[model samples]
Target: MSLPRQSISPLRQRMLEDMTLRKLSDKTQSAYVRAVRGFAGYLRRPPDTASAEDLRRYQLHLVETGVSPMSVNAAITGLKFFFEVTVERADALAKMSPVRVPHRLPVVLSREEVARLIECAGNDKYRAALSVAYGAGLRTSEVVGLKIGDIDSQRMVLRVDQGKGHRDRFAMLSPVLLQTLRVWWRTAHAQGKLLDGGWLFPGMNRVNPLTPRQLNRAIHAAAQAAGIDKRVSMHTLRHSFATHLLEQKVDIRVIQVLLGHKKLETTALYAQVATEILRQVISPLEGLPPG
Candidate 1:
């Protein structure tokens, strides 16, 4: 059973107001609140009264408790915002430091694996959704957030509004993906599961869009059904898309723009996982002649 939610304290109320004034996204606001709440629970008192030493100890506590580096860093960021912005106690977090998160290459699926995965989806809706994720390199949220009118066949682009970083951009819409979407649309319309100009992927109720969690579950089931061994998620499709494009000799800058990445370095990471490009490289041993 879920525990009863504690009533919001005045300090937390102020923090919420500060976050709202900054126009932080709802997800970010919730994360910040959760981080502060966790900190307060650790202290058994209000977070506003924390000292620099307390902050340091709390960080150490997080590390000792086996929090992942990424989550620990996120908590540190949230606490920094609370102290620096809301509490006006910037010095309180002086001794607290964020942990460095190790960089690891993302998991990518092969083209054939991707095809089999999509084909194994429980239904046509999931199959089309999976296709859009790979075909346009869209995130799962973007896939479910797509609106019927977002498909711009005339311009051959998909209008992605408020994607990651709260930025709007266009994604490539291939002929194959368009046809797949049309088929899904027709099927959904015939089943009365579609609302005009509504979500491309709807939940059981047409009023709500398909959730990221639901899409994630669908992908897991599909992956198991396809008998693919590599870790697969909706994001695996996106990684495969970018890697395949790189293997096809698509410009890194072009892929960056298509992926809506703010930095070229972010898109460049895909090159490390592009097996085809790796295969095409001439080894120094080959130039030295076989022993």
Candidate 2:
């Protein structure tokens, strides 16, 4: 009798298990899985049968189909993991180079634009949430993960524990943010959402942090009401904070530390996109009047 065949590849299942074992972020795991699945679906066969030629064709298809470079790179990364970890065939992937993506500057709001976004918030909770995103240069996740104890008012520092890469860091606290937080705290306390040791922004569960999806929705609604042209998110506030700081001549290294970037290259990109820097440069054609 023939042995039973499984539907999903065991190797792919193992990869998922490995990601969990390593404590990888859920977002990363989901992305990796989706990318890998895309490759598998294209081949219509198991990943073990996929070849360099197959990958090459996929790259061409992505470009021809007008797929963004970012998405293409993600597929390449997922394939690399399958070959390197599961199949133990790193040599097969050595010659492959992912398409080079042009550096796209992040979309950041002006100070006035940020204020307009905050003013559009219908509720105090969302306004306070966004204020923290701007005031501390915090990611949405960090803002939601905050606890009452994280606010060090005396020292004027906010402690961020085990953020990206499971590392801890401190961010400067703005008096304006602190005052808003105090008011929000009182409100949460009245709602019985603030526990002795729990998330500052609680959701359905008292101890768990507020969901990122909820924050994203609130930001989108606020942006729409504010009549801002640019796309905005909780992350946009952070980008605005960094870009504004770079405009003020703050060093890239300092920005890196504050933004919790592990690489200088990551932080350097903001310098290329700072509005103030762009504004200061006199266009080469400015001296020549239009004919």
Candidate 3:
């Protein structure tokens, strides 16, 4: 007996193709597709049959189920795009109200804690990665995507190409980090590895290089070894870098440029986390006798 032929759904296939054709980053494509797929699963049917009422029910379900406000907001955005852009059902999704979330302060690490984490790295790979992260204030993705050519030793600057927002900029390259990178390069060369391609810290895949997840895992392991009690991640390194620099009296505008933030307000948020500023503040009740 002949087996029945499997078929691909037009909607899903179209979504995949659209994602590819737009040249969206793999991470973003995965997130967008997952959010939309979650909506489909919630409806218990194809997304085409979902109405604004269905979407509202899903939103309520998310809140009652204790989903993060960010996740819930992302789901709504995904469904709205699907309905409006792909399905041509704009007005229905547009009428839905958005959930509001209060802005919370970001977690930051102290410079001493950052030093311990880097020092506790078990291997050269993790050490090198964290060194660049803290030394140059690089995002995890930026660190992984670094190329040998990006480091201009003569100028003492690391050229970050197509960072966060697809914009190019330069960051200070510390002398210590450069020396360590030289050692890494020699070790990589001796192994007959280190291809002359895009990435500096290439993954075992070699061609594609290491992922942000792998970097995160390395950081997590190092944090455990260092005995850090604070919740830490790859981004925590970035936060620490920024807050530490601000505490050291570096200009906030300089940090904004280094972090590639489009808005000054975004960089100003570090003020709350800068310990040095808090230390200098005067209390109204200081020098008073006990009541």
Q: Highest TM-score among the candidates is held by which one?
A: 1
lDDT of 1 by residue, 148-208 (tens): 9999999999999999999999999999999999999889999999889999999989999
User: Which lDDT tens digits does candidate 3 get at residues 1-291?
Assistant: 111225447786666566677666667666766787898888889988877788778888888999988888887776766677667788768446678987988878787888899989876767888889888889988999898799899999999988887789998888999987887777876775588755678888667777899999888998999999888998888888899999889999999998889999999999998988899998878968888
- In model 2, how large is the Cα lDDT of residue 124? 75
RMSD (Å) of each candidate, 1 decimal: 2.4, 4.6, 3.9
lDDT to native, each model: 0.93, 0.84, 0.82
Residue-level lDDT tens digits of model 2 in 230-253: 978888999998999899898889
TM-scores of the models, in the given order? Answer: 0.96, 0.86, 0.90
Residue 184 C-alpha lDDT in model 1: 93
Error of 3 at 32 (Å): 1.6
> Given candidate 2, what's the lDDT at residue 211?
90
Q: List the residue pairs that clash in candidate 2.
A: none
Q: Score candidate 3 by lDDT.
A: 0.82
Better of 1 and 2 by lDDT: 1
